[model samples]
Target: MAENASLLVELLTEELPPKALRQLGDAFAQGLVAELRAQGFASPDAPYTAYASPRRLAVLVKEVAAQAPDREIVVKGPSVKAGLDADGRPTPALLGFARKQGVAVEALERMQDGKHEVFAYRRSERGARLAEFLTGALEAALKRLPIPKMMRWGAGDAEFVRPVRGFVALHGEAVVPCSVLGLAAGRSTLGHRFLSTGPIELVRADDYEAVLEREGKVIASFERRLERIKQGLAAAAGDAQIAADEALYTEVTALVEWPAVYEGHFDAGFLEVPQECLMLTMRQNQKYFPLVGRDGRLLNRFLLVSNMQVDDPAEIVHGNERVLRARLSDAKFFYDQDRKQPLQSLVPQLAQVVYHNKLGSQLQRVERIEALASAIAGLLNADRSLAARAARLAKADLLTGMVGEFPELQGIMGQYYARHDGEPETVAAAIEAHYRPRFAGDALPGDAVGDSVALADKLDTLIGIWGIGLAPTGDKDPFALRRAALGVLRILVEHELPLDVVELLQAAHRQFPAGTLAEATVGEVHAFMLDRLRSYLRERGFKADEIEAVLAHQPTRIDDLVPRLEAVQRFRALPEADSLAAANKRIRNILKKAEVVERAPKAELMREAAEQALFDTLLSLGPQIENHMQDRRYTEALSTLAGARNAVDRFFDEVMVMTEDAAVRDNRLALLAALDRLMNRVADISRLAA
Candidate 1:
């Protein structure tokens, strides 16, 4: 056996979905590396790299040691009571223990420790060969690695994300022996399907990558494939700009075993369609890159990446051209059909389609959005008429032919269709922006109209679902309420728009049909939105509990969240705030101890000057805190909270709050309650870190 042998394996299958393959490649590499380390066979220079293609998934590791380290083994025998004889020497129990440990009674030595006599021995063995151990681990990983969706091919019932056709496993110059899902491992792998048909025998681990490359394939690393794809694309489209979508390029790279760039063209007449439509149609549907002319107009030509390097490139180009023609023709048809009717005509049809089984039809949802949008516009002092118009048509595109075919183009198609129907420009824009910030880090709407509609749409969805008792449970958020809530917060905070989410929810709750969701029982829903807000703040570098404390006291204004969060962050770093929190904790601890035997007092009968002083200070800060919060001066508000800390400490030191006098104790307790209320206004300072 080679002492420092390493292994390389390749699984060549049919074209895999790009997104699926990227995820699969990452998961396979991580799992393999962990399994190698777990078996105690790690080498300093050894690491795994994964490369994916539409036709194959490959993993390579270098300079692996041939054997794991050998180590001493210790075995413990039965207790002294079971092993010792009358003379404290060998007995039947000791003999049985020795036999179990593969050591004879004569080989065993009795050692008397503090409490009992024990028998111990050391055993040593050579580590398993790398080639053998790797084969077992590889097989285990192949079977255990999760694929989002899988298929069962041929017989033997072995399921995989995609069908497995060929597998090549090489350890140095020899093949590794392992079988997975009924397929035996070998050194033979095919390349480029039709372009290269012969079996490529991987004789050496290092030579495997070269073999695939020589056979018109780029199989060694995803980075290499990405680099080649980008360079090839740039070269194909010279001076004329052909901006490659990074997301699309990543997906295209994952979809091919051997990427061959070729140019194709469509009749320039298709460019008459809006640029968004043409681009979405080509890039999203056919995965083709559209070209631009010197003037930045959509050109007649496009670029296509193929897995196969055909002898006749023109034929492949023609085939792709035909497919794109059908797609573009379908898009043109939808565009023309949508233009036949006024965009408003579709608004009535939405009522027939159910938004949810329990929560009325789409028309009802539109009504809720309209009401919610108007309220939001009023709150933000935006163009209420424009917001109402935007909300009415926000979901109108759901009934459009193009959007029905491509659900992702819901709001986008609405904007295009609304524009064609001669609606106001702001309305059309809002129609598109209603779904802003669809994912984290995505852009929110820049216009007030879009912002208002976005708020209304998300709030309506959240309130409607929560009102109906259909709130998200655990991981199953079918309504995407969590995402909707995050989008609302992003639009409000990122745009610095003033929106009272609580009041907006209340207004929306009123618009629901007679039995819409029960408005009163959505505390969990409110809690859910606050949790999302806290998470958003935490992601932006605020501490989790700090965000929670700020959100706990007030979660209505998304605009208020920023300064409050900023204050909490700055306050968290201060030594005085930490000291105050610790001091409050001590006072609460004392109060809790007293509560065990006696009740606390209210504020009216406080005789101690410290108690009265603390109450007066708390009262004085109440209006200041409200004013600071109103002005978004949260640092000032927190400082106002700091003003009462000394008074609280003095009151705790000088006065016994839990006195036997019922009225006096009640009054003292009321003072603490008032203090708690005031402190909570700035933030739950009680929740601050020490």
Candidate 2:
């Protein structure tokens, strides 16, 4: 057996797509390790380090075997009865099998094959060497990489995300001979395109990362490079805060092998444009981090991550500033050109832009949203006129120059333009906030008018898109109906608004033509929203069964869903909760089997003491539970129902519900039906049963 040692593989290439660099690096490392583990060259849980930079992708896996363990081979031969003649003598068939195995018929072992005995041959086979399998493993890993598109370089048929420049494969101090993408694997690779003097040599697989960083001036690890960039930005910002997201940090890390953060500034005069516009241009176009002062306003200054590190970065700073000035100038041009006209003037132009071919134009959609927003405002007791005006202008900015340049600035530019037009403050704010909670954990609209418009907007999309039979299927939600549904649920439940989901969908449907939608669209969308609600509640840490208990009722007033789920959770902890839940489940089964009509229990039909006592208890608890339910005190109502557990258990234990007397059985079924109503007012407690 060959000794086990760490293995290293690196691929040097042209600059990779910055946005996809992290994913590519992860796929490359995991893919290689997985394939190696599958082939028995590495352990199942082998530790590996992934390295990704602008020009390289590499992985170092620990404790990889030089050769796999030897395997045993077995070949089953003819059955004993077929192999022998009537006198139990060897036949020609058995002799032919023995000749193939290079052994006499007596050397064959007899083994049971199902119900028949068979002759078999077994032998030991040598394990595969690392050098024999490394090339194939490397090729398999590369083929499995998550490269959406592959490009071919030169005249060769070899392809990758970018042109392959070099390759390195090492096991301890030895080079595992292999070839990939027309490149022969060696122990040397280029580092930091312009920083290192020449190709760096790896003496051992374990020293790859350290050697690259020390001699090649390249930080091989993506995470380490990202952290270094973050620390540099923080230190350079000093008093000001850097305006950058995780995505920006990751992209910058991918663009640099040796990251050096430098500060640059644009003319403060460009601050007249909305800070969002400036910040987006700096981050998206120039890959710079915009600085914000303690006052929460954009500063003229920004930070840039450069691949080049030098004693004096004056030219680098000047070059970046000059490029950003051109980009910011374009943003300013769009903003100024857009503000020349009031946002309302752009509404008529929306008719030229098609929202969807199945649906009407953007103008028609905006009108629907206006009417729906007004209706929702009435439901919330907010200013209907303000909501209508906000919705009317919500998509108008989509026709503006600034929005055309930056689609993400649609609602934001609308707010700025609305304010500039001297529109009502509430309406301006609503126009901007109508798109709140755009993604998960995002903030909700700040005011009632915004809430009304936001719900109206999302509900309109959910109904219209789903109405035309374009509902999401199997992760394909091009219309984003799932997102819109989740947004509506979040607003209703989070805001605790007094609106039913079905009612909102109905109102949104009405905003369209009489025959515009399918009749069942409202019910279908409600069910879909309920599914999203289940997942949403689970993410909030509610148990699956508890959520199902409350959702079993399919309550339209989702504002109280959390309270009902909480009540179910609390009820599950009670001493009698299990017994009551089990009894409820049993009672449900009896009623289902009996198929009895629902009615109030008759006092005259009660023949047993336990039955009468359970009846009296239900009557006594009815008003208390009703009052608690009316007050929306779900926990109190469930607690009150818990008091009836003893009576419920005794009734089931003492009385036979399915009796021989038809009248008695009917009466008892009615009694259980009445109890069922009270127990399930808050939630179906039976779902909580073990």
Q: Residue by residue across 1-690, what tens digits does model 2's lDDT show?
A: 227989999999999998999999999999889988887788898899998988999999999999977878788999999899999988898999999999998888889999999988887888789888888888988999888899999988999999999999998889988899998989888878898999888899999989999999999899999999999999999999998899999889989999999999889999999999999999888899999999999999999999999999999999999999999999999999998999889899999999988778999999999999998899889999999999999999998888888898879999999999999999999999999888899999989999999999999999998998999999899988888988889988888998988888898889888887899999999999999998999999999989988989788999999888888888889998999899889888887888778678899988999999999999999999999999999999999999999899899889988888888889999999999999999999888888
**Residue ranges of candidate 1 with Cα displaced over 4 Å:** 69-126, 130-135, 148-159, 177-185, 237-245, 292-301, 308-319, 383-385, 467-469, 496-498, 514-520, 572-575, 587-630, 640-680
> How do all models score by TM-score?
0.84, 0.95
Model 1 C-alpha lDDT per residue in residues 1-690, reported as the tens digit of each score: 466666676777777777777777776766676667666666644677776777777777776666777866767677667777778777887888888887787676556666876777667777777656866776667766766667988866877778888877777777767665577888888876666768877778877668888874555567787788888888999876775568988898887767789999898888877766787888988899988888877887889888777677999999999999999998888888878887788889988999988888998889888877877888778899999999998888888887787788888888888888888999999999899878878888878878889988988888888878887889999989999989988887888877676766677777776665774745666678777887788789988777767776666777777787788778766656876676556655654664432433345577889988987787688899889877878898887777776787788789887788877776776667556656667677667755
Per-model clash counts, in order, read 13, 0
Give the range where candidate 1 is weakest over 10 consecutive residues by summed lDDT.
594-603
Among these predictions, the greatest lDDT belongs to 2
The root-mean-square deviation over C-alpha atoms between each candidate and the true structure, in angstroms, is 4.4, 2.6
